[model samples]
Target chain A: METIAHKAKLSKSSPVVRKYRALIHHQQDMPVQPDISVKHLNKVYADGFRALKDINLDIEPGEIFALLGPNGAGKTTLISIICGIVNLTDGEVKAAGFDIIRDYRKARESIGLVPQELNTDSFETVWDAVSFSRGLFGKPPAPDHIEKVLKDLSLWDKRNNRIMSLSGGMKRRVMIAKALSHEPRILFLDEPTAGVDVELRRDMWEMVRKLRENGVTIILTTHYIEEAEEMADRIGVIRHGEIILVEDKSRLMSKLGKKELRLHLQSPLEKMPGQLALEPIELSEDGYELIYTFDSQQEQAGVARLLRTLGDLGIEYRDIQTRESSLEEIFVGLVNE
Target chain B: MNLYGVRAIYKFEMARMRRTLMQSVASPVISTSLYFVVFGSAIGSRMGDIDNISYGAYIIPGLVMLSLLMQSISNASFGIYMPKFSGTIYEVLSAPVSYVEVVLGYVGAAATKSVILGVIILITARLFVDYDVLHPFWMFAFLVLTAITFSLFGFIIGIWADGFEKLQIVPLMIVTPLVFLGGTFYSIDMLPEVWQTISLFNPVVYLISGFRWAFYGVSDVHVGISVGMTLMFLTACMIAVWWIFKTGYRLRS
Candidate 1:
């Protein structure tokens, strides 16, 4: 099915498709600059705690890149340094092709940040706050743009209300609006949905998708594995202030995801039979079930052979079930490792 | 030259002042009026003139200078400090603005506020005691120069202070005492010779002496010396503010 779809996509002759293909070809011929790039980045705090260690990363334009990490993994520190909030100890960073240190004004102008903390001007009305953010980037006032951002965030009605009066969820949305106020080409959302409700999370995911469609490069750091699984085009896992893995989401899942098969035994066994002892299988504590673990991508998973061996050994099963490891399980395993 | 960024910060600070109009404007005006009622109207009526100017009018420049210095410091300090305390300063630090633009926005608004307050007080003094600005241009220059210098000093204080109490410490413990001893209500000549010499060491003496000279053409010190002293203080404050931003002292980590 996927092959046929791929073929169709390749064969499509519509004018719009052709134009898009030509545009992509043109872009391929030209050296496309990464939206964000960091080389040998390091951050050491005053007390001698190293927050980030020789980090090197590049985020392509218009991609939804989710950075997943355990707490204290230096995700916020990296983002803060890139945004010019926290000072870097060493190395270079560039945003939207502008050097972060030498061309900071242009670099900062191209990026917007939604911080993890809900720090806002409580006394400021929503409209003023959003507009202020736009102006802070040295952008001219665009009331219509501000209005659109507010409406998009479902904050238009509260435009005149003081931020102190808003609910926590609304304040989070306001943070997003403020980040988008300047119409930046790149956005960094640090735990965007940390405390958000499921519905708001869904809405935010939709909004993010829409933003990507409009060509905004989104780099989001998330503790929620599901959020990354749901929204990331590419996933990067960071641990101990170092990126351990970066790969396409589908590739990562298929490459690392493990499969498990369980067979319920017809009768209890005293122990595993000698012949089946060497197999990648485990007997349940009660001896009423057998669980086999295998890499899904292996050409020979040996499921049939295992079943035949079980039958020849006179072991019968009532039913068999298979389970695929989820991203959360994979994440926990990687972190533990 | 991120004018928009500067304007944004300036407007935001100004809006805060407007939000607390009673405290920012009315409270100081009313307190100064009380001083005028007691010291200017009642006491000055009983006292003889100094430098041939009515005692009531002699304290007018001193009173305006006193308020301008204090208000400039407090306004600029609080303006920058609140953002640091609430974490909104992250936005400013991360914005496209240079340090020059940041200072221009904050100090400019603070000085503007002080100048406006000074003008209002001068008008309020009209109701209590008649006075003249012998050199209106010089009077305006001193008002603006003092406001800007003190505002810059306040900005430095805001960056240095990690706590709210520290914000008030310099303005209260140091500034208030200096202003009181700097001849706010009495000339340094009224003091004994040794005390006068000591009073000359107070920086506020130069500010008040210069401002008083602008008003009645009579000053405790030469006007050139007072202007030079004010400029020197302004330059020192500017250097402190410059160093603060360049080093990211208490701002970035």
Candidate 2:
């Protein structure tokens, strides 16, 4: 166990070593292999709540796919359907080329899920929990593989500790370890870093990047849109039980994303006379602030024209500031619209 | 369904049960001993012989069935309920552990627990009465059937129950009351014609009566009918539990 842990520690962040890792099989020979595919998927709970509606998606092998949406936007329902946890009321799902409903065992065996909830048996040791998860997938016992998973998640020293004994961050790592125990080709992380600290979050980011390099297809969901921006290769936005937009990260930022331009006057402003509002700049209720929202895709924000209009009005500004649109802002704006 | 996954679930469940050793094995032994002390001596004396057999001997099958019923109900119900309660059901549901494996693992453990408790009670009864096995096969058959039926029923209760309070509703309210009034203390033959007919509606009486017929070779109901009743109940429960799993009735949602 120690030797395996040592090897894992030595090669964790090295992408070359990760790419050649034996158990991290990405299976590059199949060019058209989709890690998971969903077709017009729909789910309605017993109580008649439609949680998912006509969802169709294809996640390619070895890519980081992020599913983003507000609460009740069918993020968990979608992942659950793909993982074969929740049965769909309508449509079909396939995981690693097997139909989820018809070939459930085969489909589920290839995928691993890190659920949103912080769920672990408090009485069980970390080793037992991860091992039990592997056994659940009908995998034969592989202690070395388990050790490597634990070390990769930085959970080697905590292996003998009870789950309740670990801190929130360590417990989160344990969840990832449990999910990866069976050496699945695809791993789904549903809000994996919800309650962890900054360092642990960075550590998880590195681990995920390493996992990706090793050819594992990763699907993650999070309210923290920034994590998606940092880790995801392609972005999908879900709203009200339907996938609204899916685009490349850079393309989405340039296409639908916007930046905020705020000119903070060094001198406090008096009341905005009704005439000053005609330039598309809104005054705060307090009458001391000016706000401008501009699209980044545009060649120019027409800042010169606005300033020329301001100068003609004889409004002297002491300072100006511009804030670019982040993934968080674009996400919130998309959902609202 | 893969049997290895079933076995894994069984091992995990049994380990959990063993962790609370007192609840599964010891508690039943202790409680059955107390029943023999109070009911066998205190109540059996006044009740006199039942159908040419001592009152102590007559209620033996009923008492054994009582523990069997309770244990089976709790074993399956608590097994599944704990997962749902602790949010570990997410791991279970997400895993390759199919509903068939889940039902078999949970119901199998429940049946195992019931059989264990039944044997313990029978061994303990040796100190109190002179009981002999007339037909060991019949006794074994009834024991297995009763265990499976109640365990399947318990599996249903586990699935239907919403929370902690919901888990107790069937065991405390329906199952226990039926076991007590199911001729455990008195044979239905001693009852008035109207009461005897009413007792027929209590399905538990059939289970206890069937078990008594296995042991003593005499019954208020025909042995063939008792066996048939056992088969009928076992079949019904199996189908119902299978359907619940197939549709993912309460579990999937």
Would you list the C-alpha lDDT of every candidate in the order shown?
A: 0.89, 0.80
Q: For this target, which candidate reaches the highest TM-score against the unseen true structure?
A: 1
TM-scores of the models, in the given order?
Answer: 0.94, 0.85
Tens digit of lDDT per residue, candidate 1, span A1-337? Answer: 0111101011122233234334444764665566788888888999999998778787777778888889999999999999999999999999999999999999999999999999999999999999999999999999999999999999999999999999999999999999999999999999999898999999999999889877788999998999999988777778888877776677677777888999999998889899888888899999999999887786265788898898898888999999988888777877787
The stretch of ten residues in a row with the least summed lDDT in candidate 2 chain B is B1-10
Q: Is the docking of candidate 2 incorrect, acceptable, medium or high quality?
A: medium
Model 1 is docked with a DockQ of 0.92
Candidate 2: stretches off by over 4 Å = A1-31, A46-48, A258-323, B41-47
lDDT of 2 by residue, A38-151 (tens): 777888887888888788787766778888999889999898888866788988788988998888888889988999898889988899889888888888889999999998
